[model samples]
Target chain A: MKYKSQKVAYWFFAFSMLLLILQIIYGFIMAFAHLGYDNLHPVIAFNTARAVHTNLLVVWLLSGFMGAAYYIIPEEAEYELVNVKLAYIQLITLALVGVTAVIGYHFNYWEGRKFLEIPRPLDWLVVANVLTFLGIILTTLFKGKKRTTTSLVLTMGLVFAALLYLPGMIWFDNQTMDSFFRWWVVHLWVEGVWELIMGGILAFLLIKITGVDREVIEKWLYVIVGLTFISGILGTGHHYYYIGVGKVWLIVGGIFSALEPLAFLAMALFAIAMYRKGEKKHPNKIALSWTLGTAIVSFVGAGLLGLAHTLPQVNMYTHGTLVTAMHGHLAFWGAYGMIVLAFISYSLPNLTGRKLYDSNRGVLAFWLSNIGMLGMTVAFGVAGVAQVYLERRVGLEFGDVQKEIQVHFLILIICATMFTTGIGLFIAEFIRYGQPTDEALIAATDHDA
Target chain B: MLSKSQAKVFFLGGTMVTFVIFLGLSWNSLSKEVPKRTHEENLTAQVVAGKHIWEKNNCMGCHTILGEGAYYAPELTKVYERRGEAYIKVALMTKTPWQPRGRQMVAYGMSDKDASDVVAFLKWIGEIDLNGFPPKPDLKK
Candidate 1:
């Protein structure tokens, strides 16, 4: 940590860890509910559990990204955050809103729009909070010594993400129109702007960890993001394919969404190439493993697995089936979840002034969580394929099909337990790092590599 | 051979072009195709009210409509046609938990009017043109 304000990032990351634990707990609830142990029906309900699980994932990721921005912006732009106090206030409000929304889900106080389950009134608060976050990042960037491409891409992603949230808030009586605009927020965020944020952070990590030159990394960054938009924007049609949209989407969405994997492929290849090219290898093996793991796993999870069903032909059968649950689990974990954890692992040592880089526990956390998630992904995929065959293909009843697949949920719960244990170890290490302090601040930022 | 400047151009220029096309296509879909396909003229106040009830109860959180939402329950985009108004009304207005084959649903215990409104909403959704989704089981014996 080179700047005083960068320490604020630690709290955001800590908060993310808390929310993630909650998310995993909710995930277990839904999994057990699937396994015929829905004893919490009157109290929590599957829908309520589902909403909290998915929404908490979103909130924690956003908090992690915000923390990444706080930590990255000052160093890249060569300036301190404009207002540390406002950033803290923003953090508090973010938590309050998240907690309130999670509590409200129990009582059925939500919008029922899947990922955008936060009620409309609370939507305005989210907008305000995000605007305040953008204000701080933008002000800090403009007032700094220079505006690097890395910072610009990251900030642009943040700005566009805030802008995209607007379309989801619009009330529509027609479900088609309602779903149409909701994709503008959900699809565009995960496949679109979020990739930009991921790319920007990935570039920064490579530069620091691999000792790669900034120029080379930032150049590939542009190409990667360019590929992302070219494919991802039109790729929104994949969702439109089954919704009440025109047939043009069948063609446009199929062609472009098929190309979406290319971006992930490029990202994975880019990270690997940078790693091989770098002459200086930093001693932070754990961070390097996560950074590389995210790129590779995202390709298989987001790119290859997505391609397994992106075609309109295959999707017709898999559209609402557990097939989606299969792809979604890995995609979110690889693309966003792991990236946040990677950034945390990379920065934690620097922030706390502790060079606990050689711990066997840290390495174990990385592999166990990743392999466990992979196992869970396979369980979901097997159950999903069986469901598509039984419910969609063989014309079995939905409930009967679910009963047949109950065994897979047992496997899912077991794998998830392994994943949770890994995260527990990660968090234990996080706590052991103590807290960020002024003594951790290094005199020279360029000394990272 | 891509230089830094050219890559930047590619990023900005590609984003601009694709965003324009996306907006244009969205406008066309919303303005031209959606009305005709969805039969917007039939979106009566009761249907809108039904949608309100759907959202208020967070039904999509459990049962999917349009192949979007949680897959915990059966897809309901065609429920109006499959189950008919009376069957759906029973499920809605039932005072007890409506567990089908032992999987429980929240017993909204809605009023008759709200049930009918929800039925109307499902009916409207049932007729919308989805370009042949939830495809028939070809291998079914």
Candidate 2:
């Protein structure tokens, strides 16, 4: 909102929304497929559906992060983006590459790596796209008048994420070596660098909504970053446990990953503490709701739930079961997903010059999505525990266990419907706000003046 | 509360320590643990080719190897011991796509050479020392 160039983020966010819708559709496909409705099995097999679902989730989240950077970096650095046109070009290329990769999965033209199915050729495109993005962000930051801690942390996360992608691209003939390095990308990004991104965004939101001093907010950002590095870097060992790796990872992974929740807990506490200390006079209650909601919910979903199965003993039984799906759903939803929603909620009105944050629709969207996702988590949890008992403990055949668990998909479908409805409402609000306009820019500039 | 400068120092120092530890752990795994059991000598040309085939086919999208993939399919880590390479080849050749008895396996229409290589790759993985993961469940009722 501070600069005309910031308007470019709107397209990125819009693109992300489209992909999210596609992701949810694939989610439904898988859910129904789980219910024995393999009607689409031949064309859109479960594996293909899964690849699209997960890959779409990742791409949309990355797009959201890119959008956040575009919006935040300008304001934080006190300047317009150096080249707005290049930013637009980057967004288009990113979308094109993402679409190509997702489509390729249908033809089995991808590596089998979880969360990293993009074929090598497309991977190179991704690298180029990200380089363009970082070039714009970094050039703007360095060229601007000032660079804040929040901006620095966010930039560091982006840089590390870009670097981490290399390990996954490296071709290895040894399966163990390949799996070991793949986690360097997947585990490190989500648990390590992405936390920095979340913290930076959370700090920016809290400072804005709570009317807190930048000093106070940035102080907590440091603590969160500290806790993140202390626990998260070593936390990569968690995924190393059964991957034909050495045993030291068990102790290293278990102990460190158990501590990963502390960072999230610190995040929750940081947000609440800031809110309590503020004057409580920000008129944008919807944005405040999402900011606070992200904090508390991420703690539960990512922190507590992550801790539940992080230990080696528990993980032995639940490594790849629905238990993982249980943790994965809530963790991603609460942490990155909610934070992106918070950013969108906070920035949309300012960009569009609309003051629609107090509507019933906004509140409904917040509660419906949170409640629906929580229900889905519970559904996945129950099904997962039952699965562990029946399949792993009872030694029932995998197919029988899956059949036994089909009933849970009913609950999953119902809850997912609610979640999707909430998302639909959120997107509706985004559309209602319309596009960013010159008048909004004038208003923002006048308000600042 | 720590001052800004103090907090910055603490953050930087902590980050360095964390990095050092991570490096240490990774080196241990690479130098000692991986070498101890990976048995580089046993990794034949066929095994290496099989690993590529496994990745090319996106097998890990469904079947887990060493408990690290989608759980919809059975774990392939021990498949060599559970079902021999011959059975695996036939399963691939038939392209049944689904088993009436258990979870379905998609027919990838893998060539015989590819199938044999994939089996070799799984066998190589199964031979590595996992340091006691997927520990034996107490089945004695």
- TM-scores for all predictions: 0.99, 0.97
Cα lDDT, all candidates: 0.93, 0.86
Give the runs in model 2 whose Cα sits over 4 Å from its true position.
A445-449
Q: Candidate 2's residue-wise lDDT over A135-227, tens digit each? A: 999999999999999999999999999999999999877677888899999988998899899899999998888878899899879888888
If you assessed candidate 1 against the hidden native complex, which CAPRI class would it receive? high
Best by TM-score: 1
Q: What is the DockQ of each candidate?
A: 0.86, 0.62
Clash pairs detected, candidate 1: none
List runs of model 1 lying over 4 Å from the truth: A443-449
Fnat for each model: 0.82, 0.57
- The residue-by-residue lDDT of candidate 1 on B28-117, one tens digit each, is 999999999999999999999999999988898889999999988899988888899999999999998768977899988999999999
Let me know the TM-score candidate 1 reaches against the reference structure. Answer: 0.99
Worst 10 residues of 2 chain A by lDDT: A440-449
**Residue A339, candidate 2: C-alpha displacement in angstroms:** 0.8
